[model samples]
Target: MQTYEIWDSEYRFMTIVWDNAPIGSGALCTLCLQQLGWKKSTVYNAIRKMCEKGLIQNENATVRVLVPREQVQREESDAFLRRTFSGSLPGFLNAFLSGRTLSEKEAEELKKLIDAHRKEG
Candidate 1:
């Protein structure tokens, strides 16, 4: 899988694309203008940069993501956790949950996900 690193500004732009894609490029540009207050040139610049990076595809004036949102999110999340938490998920969770109470449903869902992963691995 191809992974791309997105800076904070670019992530905002990409989030819009991820949320509203397989949309017409013109439509996406319009949304960017309305939602993000971007001009056409700014939107086109971002689109071209992302397209060159293989993060998105613009063909026939239609825009679609080349990389799925989950994949990019996972990669970015993993990188962040590794860098900030020394690659220790338990450590990261401990820090994240410090003085915090998770709801039963949230805990159950997390447990289920962990169990499924364990079983799969």
Candidate 2:
């Protein structure tokens, strides 16, 4: 899998693009200004950077995501969990659920997912 590295600034920029992609560049710039407190230069710089990195494209003043948001998020989550928990899913889950409570529905859904994966494996 060809996962690209996204720095914090780039991630923030890509989030906006992913959320409003296939959007007019002008409208994207306006949204960034309102949501991110970014200047025109900042938005343009991020646009150029992501374009060069193959994360997005600017064609005829329209912005489009070259990589889907789900792919990026999955890659980022896997990388983070591996790095932080030495590739241990239980360790990662323990840390993630620490000091937090899941709703009954969420707990049930998670249990079902675990059971399904276990059966598949």
lDDT of 2 by residue, 1-119 (tens): 76677777678888888888899989998999999999999899999988998889999999998998665642354544354677788976877778346788999999999999999
Residue-by-residue lDDT tens digits, candidate 1, 54-111: 8999999998988876666423545433546777889768877783467889999999
Any residue pairs clashing in model 2, and if so which?
Answer: none
Q: Listing every candidate in turn, what is its Cα RMSD in Å to the true structure after a full C-alpha superposition?
A: 11.2, 10.7
Worst 10 residues of 1 by lDDT: 74-83
CA lDDT scores, all candidates in order: 0.83, 0.83
In terms of TM-score, the best-performing candidate is: 2
RMSD of 1: 11.2
